[model samples]
Target chain A: MKLGVLFSGGKDSLFACWQAIQKEEVACLITVVSQNPESYMFHTPNIRLAALQAEAAGFPLVEVETAGEKEEELLDLKRALLAARERYGIEGVVTGAILSVYQAARVQRICRELGLWCFNPLWLADQEAYMEELIGAGFTVVIAGVFSAPFDESWLGREIDRRTLDELRAIAQKYQVTLTGEGGELETFVVDAPFFAQKIAIEEASKVYRNYNGVLRIERAGLVAK
Target chain B: MILVVDLCYRDGSLSRDEFVAPVERILCRAETPFLTRHYTAVGAPDLKSADAAILCGTALMDTGYMEQPELFRWLLSFERPVLGISSGMLALAAAFGGGTEPCCEIGMVDVNVLAPDPLFAGQEVFPAYEVHEHAVRVPGEFVALAASDRCVQAIRHRSLPLYGLLFYPEVRNEWIVERFLGLAARQSP
Candidate 1:
């Protein structure tokens, strides 16, 4: 079956795309860019870079803009799915939802309304095992945003290597946070994946952090030959 | 050992991770032993060895398993404790002459327990995750255990340990699966 993934330039969505490609034909990557940084449904940090990731993975991208209003964002998502179905002839949609019923339910409804099948590969996944697989599968993920405490500015733009994962594991146990950041405690960006023909090179970036809330905004990035 | 049945469209399908793995994870955390096999691949040895069985759900649009009701006829005689979820529930009902109706529920729903059963002994009303396109008609040999405002949420055999839930208990309701494991342990040798 041909499917379109809801890409957010984050590890979860990209990882979901990887899984979808392995099982079905990932015809395109659909992204909904929200203006509100506090949007609950969409990932905000460096979301514009989804196009570059899509290009690296050799998939068409369907980009949609949303004002980020509560319910209006869902309408924008529906529009995006319609566009994907029209352009790519996708039969279903894939999501990276891990444990958020709020996000999963909303997306499920939209897909049902569109008469499209929805699949959440990472739904209710074991967090630690998922993180281990993400790293073991040669996915180079870096922390893009941190929303909760126990995470300082030093974690910005930090690649999730073994050492970083170890630290996160300890923090997860001590701070009551999810290891894969499913609770909005952190956000991640994949610079390179096993499926990527090229890797993302960060040319210029800036960090905006205060009181445990921070984002590594990628001001300039380009695809580089791996 | 618990037999975790995969009810996806095909063996090792993409839907396996979404439907089967979560339930396996709950069992893993509970330190329970299990074996998984696709519905088409299950054999007599699997039924003979499993102390209990949990038939996992499938994607909403994937009902290929429902087309072959004979594959599940074994459930009628297996007699061991069984828990069928969502699409698995439909299959379980079909094995006993029950049919499905057009009742679509997606996302979190409030379920009200109507009967006194160990599965929901303490809980009266609770939220559950549902992603089914149709609701099973309560089989003649079974009684409705719980329900949402729209449709029946749970059912169990009048005398057997067979049970069916129209929701995915792996999401935020892992306790239910754990409780079922506890029940299965007590009923098993």
Candidate 2:
């Protein structure tokens, strides 16, 4: 069945999309421009970049902008789904909700309201195994934000390594943080994937550290082959 | 300082997984101490010395405790403030009342707080992310602290050395966590 994968430009969403394409029918990519997503608000942050993901996965991009919070966010999503369902005739939707029911429930509700079946490709999967599957599938996912107190600015721009995965497994037991960053502990972005015809490369980047968190901004991003 | 009572078969529950890390986070947030112990290494000093206690959930039948009775008796002997999540709540109920019946598994369900309770921290209404399978009816005298749209979510022995929580408040959300920390901090000193 043709499916619309909700693309957040995050590693999980990108992986979800790839999973759908693997099943042979990813029809489109959708993203929400949140007013308070901790990134750009006016437009869907990283979606202008999604043209690359669309090219990578050979799918069309649909950008939905919600310039406010919660209810407005839901409304924006409903509009996007209805349009996608009508235009693409999508049978189902795929999402990347690792442990937060907040996002998953909203997506299910919207799909129910729109007469679309909701498909969460990554629901209830083991956290470590999930990350491994993401990396094993060959995606260059990077840390986009960090709110976990134990993490530092030095972690920004550090490619997710096996060591980092091991560290997440070990320290997560010590601190009770989810391996998937479910509590807004951190955010991520995928720069490359197996499905990508071309990969995202960052030439000019700067890391800015703050009291509780930091961001590694990619001033320049371009498409390149792995 | 805090004490954790962990007595259960492995893998039937996940509360013990979050039990230590969670209290440690709250203690770290409040600048308190986090402790650990083994069933073999501990004696009365391990529990009676703590400001509060946390009992990790278990799927091991209360019948085992009844068969042995000594360990369960020792656990109830602590008389320190207690917080029970999942099977821990069953243990608390069995400690005062009787055993639990096997019921439908519960997870990702929403819980609404019934107020004038310390765990809820005076909120009129809010959501709790639940991940449990079974719960016991509170003893006749215990007060219900929180409830879902269905069964009892929590119970507390009024005016005593115990409190029981059906939800893992530590990882539930930041708000309930802040409330749990506030009360934990007050109790610490």
Candidate 3:
């Protein structure tokens, strides 16, 4: 089946894409860029890099801009899916939703309306196991945003490796936060993946952190040979 | 051990992670032992060994399991506790001469308990995650236990431990699966 992935330049979305590529043809990467930094459904931090990631993975990208209103963002997502179906002839849509019924249901409704099958490969996944698999799968994921306590500016731009995962596991157990950041406690960006033909090398970035809230703003990045 | 039956389009398909793994995680957290097998590969020995069975859901667009109702005929004679979820519910119903109607519900919805059963005991109304394209037309041998405004949300056999839920309990409703497991544990020899 030809499918379009809802890419967010995040680990979950990219991991979902990798899984889809194994079983089906990933026809395109669909991204809905929200102007609202706190968009309910779409991932905000480093979302623009989805195109680069799509290019690295050799998949077509369908990008759409949204004003990020409460319910209006869903319309923009629908527009992106429609565009992907028209351009790439995708039969279904794939999502990276792990535990958010709010996000999953909205996407499911939209896909049903579009007559496209919706598949959330990460739906209700075990968070710790999922994080372990993400690292074990050779995905070089870095912290791009943090929104809760116990995460300081030092965590920004930190690659999620074994040591980081071990620390995250301890923090997750202590702070009662999800290890995979499914609760909007954190955001991640993938610099490399197993399927990537090239790796993303960050040239310049800036960090803005205050009171446990921060973002690793990638000022410049380009694809490099793996 | 609990037999988790994968009802996806094919064994080891992408949908298994979505449908089967979550249930396994729930069982794992509960410290319960479980074994998973695709519906097509389930032999008599599997049914014989399993203390209980949970038939997992599939993607809304995947109906490959429903086409082969004969594969689930064992569900009719097997008196062991069984819980079917979403597409698995359709399979359980089909094995007992139940059909389905076009009733689509995708998202969180309010489910009202219509009949008192241990699966939903003491919970009059609750929210459930539903991702089904059709609703089972409650089989004659089963009684409707709960419902949403749109369609029946749950059903169970009149005498057997067989049960079917049209919602995915693994999502924000792991308690349902836990309750089923508890019920199974009590009924086990």
- Write model 3 residue lDDT over A42-156, tens digit each, in one string: 8568888888998999988999999999899999999999999999999999999988888999998899899998888988777878888988899999999999999999999
True interface contacts reproduced, per candidate: 0.65, 0.02, 0.79
Better of 1 and 3 by DockQ: 3
Model 3 misplaced regions, further than 4 Å: none
* Least accurate 10 contiguous residues by lDDT in model 2 chain A: A38-47
- Model 3 Cα lDDT, one tens digit per residue, B1-189: 999999998998888899999899899999999999999999999999999999999888889998888899999888999999999899999999999999999889999999999999889999999998899999899999999999999999999999999998888788999999999999888
- Candidate 1 clash pair list: none
- Cα misplacement distance, residue A177 of candidate 3 (Å): 1.8
Scored by TM-score, the top model is 1
How would you encode candidate 1's per-residue C-alpha lDDT over A1-226 as one tens digit per residue? Answer: 9999999989999899899989989999999999997789885799999999999999999999998999999999999999999999999999999888899889988998988889999988888889999999999999999999999999999999999999999999999999999889999999999999999999999999999999999999999999
Tell me the whole-model lDDT of each prediction, alpha carbons only.
0.93, 0.64, 0.93
Pitting candidate 2 against candidate 3, the one with the higher DockQ is 3
Candidate 1, superposed: residue stretches over 4 Å from native: none
The candidates, ranked best first by lDDT, are 1, 3, 2
